[model samples]
Target: MKEELIVKAYEVAKERYAAIGMDTDKAMDALQKVQLSLHCWQADDVTGFESAGELTGGIQATGNYPGKARNIEELRQDVLKAASYIPGNHRLNLHEIYGDFGGQFVDRDQVEPKHFESWMQWAAEHNMKLDFNSTSFSHPKSGSLSLSNPDKSIRDFWIEHTKRCRAIAEEMGKRQGDPCIMNLWIHDGSKDITVNRMKYREILKNSLDEIFATEYKNMKDCVESKVFGIGLESYTVGSSDFYTAYGASHNKIVTLDTGHFHPTESVADKLSSLLLFIPEVMLHVSRPVRWDSDHVTIMNDDTLDLCKEIVRCDALDRVHIGLDYFDASINRIGAYVIGSRATQKCMLQALLEPLDTLRKYEANDQGFERLALLEEAKSLPWNAVWDMFCLKNNVPVGEEFIAEVEKYEAEVTSKRN
Candidate 1:
């Protein structure tokens, strides 16, 4: 991690890449410009400030790691600490339940932008932007279904909540001078076989139409889908096809969570198709072990493929990348650093690819050469470039961040009783 070593390695890497008709400086510049949205729930294990029941809706945070943020101040401190190790300035993704309700119960149906004024002030103070999500799980009304609930009363309650969420997102966007990406994901499904699938989807479509009835200038709306949840294995109301079709027809952005699909399903392959139709796409990058466990993301094949496809399609500006995982089993700050840095590494690798050369091989019908070049590209000195990026950003390079997280745990988080 020495300055001389970093500079020398980067020079060598630059030369090697230049030989392949790639520019390391341009790749580094592009990598630095891509801002990822860090999820807030990671600091507190999805246990928002709202006085809700245990985590439900087929989601659960599994560990009891100490030093978890007990309030907004502590959570902000933790996120800022995590950001220090990450490479670039990023936005924070907030859930409705994380609003500053002042210890008073503000039910989802009646929640408003006032509840999040403090967050907006805090984000502005830190020079950070924000994104929003409608909290549709772990509430008394979240049993069995939400927007697609059979009962009109239950469905209306969620509809109102979502409408208020969008309104809040708009205010945040206007305040920050950027469009807040408001993502709506509901765990509406059946634990057992249900015969009313069509009926539920129809209700969902109607609810979405009503929620999006009023357009705001500063917020962009996105709909997310999942394969299944813990108990909701029998049926997932918002499947991929449902959201893809709905997003296309309604002119809304579709969010693709990496862990929301089957293990064998290629999330990368879906990007090209979705990009052609949707105006934009949002990514909830997470690591799913055997199922949607929501483990912290790493530099694995799933993530690599996802980043590669995005670069291949030249969809850097068209896609919104956000980390979506909460592993309370480890140090929360470490989890954030690992996942965020790993994502950046994957993007750096993708950006360093000699796409022009590889594409030329494909265009010339040289399949074998194309395949060989890709294999060779894997062994390129992308790590040296990544180290330089961290150095330039004034963050710990390589495994040095591990010690920093430990130091914070001892000095800051461990004292929280």
Candidate 2:
């Protein structure tokens, strides 16, 4: 969009929001401060740089979209291209399998900070921070379980892998001068009924205790729980209850992946409860149609409510937001831009809300007035402010980013074959 039109529209939007006791400038500033952690797997459909093994562990990435990144350079280039279209500075979330190992096979347990030295240097060059995750699936030993697995030798391997990942995350944080959110998720469950539920959880708890025994000041440990996976339909060893209880008791950050819950469950409602106990929370923002499909996030009601809750609770700095989805059905870069922008839009909408007025009405027992004002706030000039934000950030405003993605695909990704 033209700069003149954006400026005019923003002026009008600023006045409109001012009438509702909202400050557009403050909202824009808050939006700029939110540094979303973009997932690296989105560029390559979770097919990491490790072996060409089939994706196991109850996870799968559908669609055969072309131009998937084949190596570290291509992946980083694709991510950089996607980041250019986004507004603010962001962090890159990396899985253990995506390390730059120089064509050498560094198994999970044998991996170290040296395997990721090139990545750290690359991130430094790009002025981007890094986050880390332990890859517990798509391996030979992943069939049974990792941390929760009863077999000591198999479990020990994964435990070692997670420890190394934490160490790597600590080093990343130390290098970047910010805490690296190291998230740990495992597809550890049974396809059928599991008889020894207590035993499995106990073993998993012990494993986590050992993994987190050596504390690092630079990295924050977050434990993620899943409802189920593709093959593990009957029971998930690390259910929501287990992780919530563990996180609260152990004072560790708990990760809430929107797709990792039941269809009818409200992820937003748990935010307040978790904030009261845990020091911090990590959010894996995604869209789940009816299950844990890991679809690209959109500016839907679910996402809106999540953002609203975060703003309402005044926990913006406490809750770390990150994208966690891989959809190969469309242009990979397009998916990244769309998901990240949608999330930012949600945050903008939340920031533009007349929260003070609404809360005052509620406190005064004026339910009808509060509901009426909220309904009226829905059609406010949020888009104008969003456009202004993009304009200020020097990115393509509105749907202009679509053309940029198409151009990239034609000139860059399409020739990958």
lDDT (Cα, tens digit) per residue for candidate 1, span 1-417: 388999999999999999999999999899989999999999999999997468999898989989999998899999999999999889999999999999999999999999999999999999899999999999999997999998999999999999999999999999999999999999989889999899999999999999999989999999999989989999999999999999999999999999999899999999999999989999999999996559999999999999999999999999999999999999999999999999999999999999999999999999999999999999999999999999999999899999999999999999997
**TM-score versus the correct structure, for each prediction:** 0.99, 0.99
The 0-to-1 C-alpha lDDT of every candidate, in the order given, reads 0.95, 0.94
Q: What is the lDDT of residue 323 in candidate 2?
A: 97
Estimate candidate 1's RMSD in Å: 0.9
Collision pairs in model 1: none
Q: Which 10 consecutive positions of candidate 1 have the poorest summed lDDT?
A: 51-60
Which residue pairs overlap in candidate 2's backbone?
none
| CA error at residue 221 for candidate 2, angstroms | 0.2
Which residue ranges in model 2 land beyond 4 Å of their true spot? Answer: none
Separate clash counts for every candidate: 0, 0
